[model samples]
Target chain A: MPMPQVPFDDRGLAYGDGVFETVLLRAGVPVLWDYHYARLLLGCQRLNIPLPSREQLVATWQSPPNAELEILKLILTRGSGGRGYATPDNSQPRLLSRRTPFVVNADRWHEGVNIRICQLRLGHQPLLAGIKHLNRLENVLARQEWNDPAIAEGLLGDADGWLVEATSMNVFWQQAGALFTPPLSQCGVAGTLRAALLDHGVVQEAAIALTAIHQVDRLWVANSVQGVWPVNKLLSETGVVLQSWNPAGHDRLQVVGHELLGYSPTSR
Target chain B: MPMPQVPFDDRGLAYGDGVFETVLLRAGVPVLWDYHYARLLLGCQRLNIPLPSREQLVATWQSPPNAELEILKLILTRGSGGRGYATPDNSQPRLLSRRTPFVVNADRWHEGVNIRICQLRLGHQPLLAGIKHLNRLENVLARQEWNDPAIAEGLLGDADGWLVEATSMNVFWQQAGALFTPPLSQCGVAGTLRAALLDHGVVQEAAIALTAIHQVDRLWVANSVQGVWPVNKLLSETGVVLQSWNPAGHDRLQVVGHELLGYSPTSR
Candidate 1:
């Protein structure tokens, strides 16, 4: 059967004039409610969309029970509108939530994953940075860079050659016992996991250089769904193989990743 | 009454993963069907969305009775999926067509428009550049740079401080009897008007510099809907006015804008 679909208008389809978030749900409970709410509000403020209240969001998520483990997504758009880029005369934000069974290869999260540098570079637009706004053609293009299921993720670089983040996750590398991730003041989405790690002092933020990335003792990737898994190998642009790593940051990453929604790290 | 709203899972709302076109319909025929169809196909190819044949697009438009001027919008999203950025597996694209009363203030296009430099810098993702893909948070932020009604449009700049285009349209400036526009290979949507102007030998593409704009003899903005309008005032970041513009491009813009649009420029 066809899943029920939404009929969005030009604003949502013409311009990525909205914001969204995917929450990890287990036993019908959405994890990181507060953090996600905060991010959603910030995104609304940034995009000038009148935020549908947090209570409204919560009510929608908890309205009904569904599959035990599912991915809950909240999309907030500027509602339907006419042509042109101007905000509507009267703006009412559209809030929607749906639950679907969340599935992923558990083995990949446990065994270190492999990633390649994508050819597509993210443009630097600070005004639209950090928040998980819907203008993600960059991510879409980056994700489509390869079709090999073996390649777990693709790392993106900004126009100036600065390493930004992975296609769908924030990146962290440990060097000399210090956790460092790229600062997203310019580009890249600040993932929920990266935010938690930053708060817990498990990961640090900095501008990561492409050349310096290989020197890190260990490399790991994190997102709301995929907690954190060390990068076993990185395929450079020239097809040179970088040695695998099991960063010490995994202990903190796994602890939080598991605690968020019971994604315990075990040998797959 | 609240307009129809799409659920968050709408592919248009989710990944900016869709295609769309807005055309002026008058006397029961679309003004620029060929241009809109060509651009829509190009957009579909760029984003990997399957394009409906021109016959399909026109069949829907022709079904409606001929009427006064209307703004016709055709939005196509990958439709709804559970979650994640991947284009939904085997998803049928949602096609939405609506006729809205054409409501642009004629004076803005007739007299001239005030253009202000926006603080929101557009990101340069090449793969998505030139195509009118959804993922328009940058434009939203740019439009939000000002709420002043007098400021007609915001001139958007890229991260490296190069002038990309306006918030919603392509820009053209005449200097020394030659017209120039920002190249869209790195950023900005390649407006249908821009293509027409280039093909008809009306304007040439170039990397517009912040310092060089002041030297131009005249300036104007063009989009499929707006056709072309002069830029009377150019407000810089420091609130300095560039100068006045001669509205000589209107005739040429309208000729190209109306060609094969099935409407005479003088009729409107």
Candidate 2:
């Protein structure tokens, strides 16, 4: 395929001035179209980008080679504008879509993953916190904090010492019989899977502190790509420890993944 | 100029995983070349993008232009990578340069710019504070906040009510006997003008509070394009008032116009 053409004045490239969503496609079909669309629309409303119609959106995904799975990226930018910080006078946003091969190691899903607490911290900007805006330097910094063979992911916290989320996923903890997740009102991306879990009555949203994270029986992170990964071991500034085990029906991480993606883990 | 080709997987476009600078070119010469290059190198160090040598950096801008005054946008993206938050393994970043015509109304510079405070607040990320990274949604949001003809540039503050900067420029407040500017340690862009002013012994950097801002006798803003403009009236949450007189070294702002661009306001 020819390289995509974006104007030099594109807000997406210029100011990191846009929002995006990466949806997992199973067998050439977008798995959660409605959920992705809703989140995209919410992002548009928050950033004031024009929301395209559902028909307009789905039409963008052209037929591609038959693959077992794919990754669809939806980018909505504030379009090309005059050379300055002020929004263009007669500006209309651009909506673009592209697809690529998806390759997730199926073995990691079952074996559970190890994560480390990142030294880089996510900032507190309530206005632009929750939505998946393009201003993602924190994620870049967090992801670059460590590059060890053992650490598969890194959890991030705000400057105020509140546990926010993983480098690329929303975090959830099981503590005291209730599922707790960090609220997005302050900071952190509102992941599609996290939203689905909440809307489906799977988890409850609550403020989780950095010190109390060790008390949770099970800790897992969720995003659109990596649906959920149970955090078996957490490495922090203090010390490392294996998370306690829990046995509950739909509350179990294994059961949740099975119900969502129709796959069962080998270890569980 | 033909559009530069960027891969869909390029981290710059994907996650805004990069840094950028827009230098002003006057009579085929870039002003503050050393300062701009230093900032870019510092930003690369902070964002982990490999710093191009000074010769390589200058080579990118070595091109004949159709316009006398041009805006050179230097984009340093963390090149192409697959779906992930981590930096690409042994990946070289993409550095592209494009030139566009520079047009600024001289009248607006001569007369003080009308400004407003934006509803959106910049997040406090100390790690990414001073660098000119690509994650600039806060500026975009603040720029998009108003469409009033009376208001020109908009001021942005951090979540903690600390005075940061404007959408596209660094702000200066002269209270009592000292010239003070907001520190970019936690929020705001460490603008080239701010750095230059400090280097040239124009202003002193300090952590400014919102309550102490009104005490400023004279107010002015500075940027690469528009050098400096004395404030006539400062519209705040409290009320609008005439800015006290303190000759900001330029009564008509033409001194800055000529000093930065080398062309008098009457000439071009």
Candidate 3:
């Protein structure tokens, strides 16, 4: 059966003129609601899209029965309009949500995961930076750089050769036991977990140059769905191990801070 | 009444992972079919999308009754899939077409139009630079820089400060009677009309510096739907005329060369 779809003229589909949030729903509750809502609000404000009230979002969260884990994604866009890039004056914002069963990656969460460097570099646009907008072709193309099952993620650097992020996660690392993550003022999506970690003060924001990737003591990747996972290996596009690490105990602190919703060890 | 919409999971909506073509249909026959098809093919190939055969497009073009001029927009998107940046294996491309009544802009065509320098400097990403992909928020934001009816278009400069193109059209300028346009190697859409003009040996491709805007003798904008339009005045975002041109008879050469799809004096 066909599912309901967004109107073709919807700006979200047409121009990618919208924002989205991917929430980790555990037991029918969207984890990190405050962080996700904050990011969504910021995205809406930046794009000048009238945000839906908090009550509206609360109503959406009430749907579907309690479950162990489900990926709840919400997309908010400038609604249906005629052809042209200029937004319509009376345009209404449309909000859409979907939920999908998420199988926790027990292997990656427990044993750590391998990631690769993407040849595709992110472009700098401060206006659209930090928000998780729909204009994500860079991520799509970066992800295309590797297809090996062993390669769990791809790291993307900005055009200025600063490590921006992993394909779908925020990248963090420790050097001399000092933890830091890339600042996203120029480019890259500001993941909710990254924001929480920064707010939690356990992670400091810094510009990690792409040339210094190999100098890090330990690497970690985090997102709302997968939580924080220690990066076990770094691979080149050709599947060559450029750097290796034993992340078993390295990410223990982040996991122990799981009470903050930034860590999820779904090792079932 | 609601029209059919694209599936929620379509990668085009999700990641802007697709390409599109906006054509002008005259009496139900698509104008510049060859150029449009060629560009579409290139876009599909660049993104690794399977192109619908020419026959399929021709069949689609057969729809709708004969009309003077209607906008024919065809959007090809990677089909529905799960939440992830990776292009799903064996993903099929979905082709969608819509025809919009195009009121001939007789005034702008005959009297020329006003254009502005966009405040938003487009980011540089060579990989997705030239194609008319779904990721068009830059253009969208640039279009939002002005709302005056007198401003027909806004010109975008790249991150390196080169005049890339107009918000929705290819830009051309004549200096000392030598026609030239900015190269799209770094960024900006390669319009079909721009390609045709380049092929016809009328306009030469050149790197146009944003600082050189005042050095141009005359300016023009071109696209498949609107054809060629003389730019009479260049304005700042505040509607201040930074530069002005009396384009009355200067654009006579382009209009006379309507043999190419570059001119459409829709004065009716």
Go through the candidates in order and give each one's DockQ: 0.56, 0.70, 0.79
lDDT of 3 by residue, B17-95 (tens): 8988898888788878898898888888778888998887887678765467788888888877688898899788888
lDDT of 1 at A224: 72
Positional deviation of residue B113's Cα in model 1 after best superposition, in angstroms: 2.7
Best by DockQ: 3
- Which residue pairs come into collision in candidate 3? none
Models 1 onward score TM values of 0.90, 0.92, 0.95
Q: Give the chain A TM-score for each candidate.
A: 0.92, 0.91, 0.94
Model 2: residues with Cα > 4 Å off, grouped in runs = A62-65, A237-251, A264-267, B237-268
lDDT of 3: 0.83
* lDDT of candidate 2 at residue A46, scale 0 to 100: 79
lDDT of 1 by residue, A79-161 (tens): 76656677887756667666677775566666778888888788877777899888887787677677777788888888887
Q: Interface RMSD for candidate number 2?
A: 1.5
CAPRI tier for the interface of model 3: medium
Better of 2 and 3 by TM-score: 3
Model 3, span A35-64: residue lDDT tens: 999999899888889999988887766876
**Highest TM-score against the true fold, candidate:** 3
lDDT of 1: 0.74
Reproduced native contacts, each prediction:
0.74, 0.80, 0.83
Worst 10 residues of 1 chain A by lDDT: A1-10
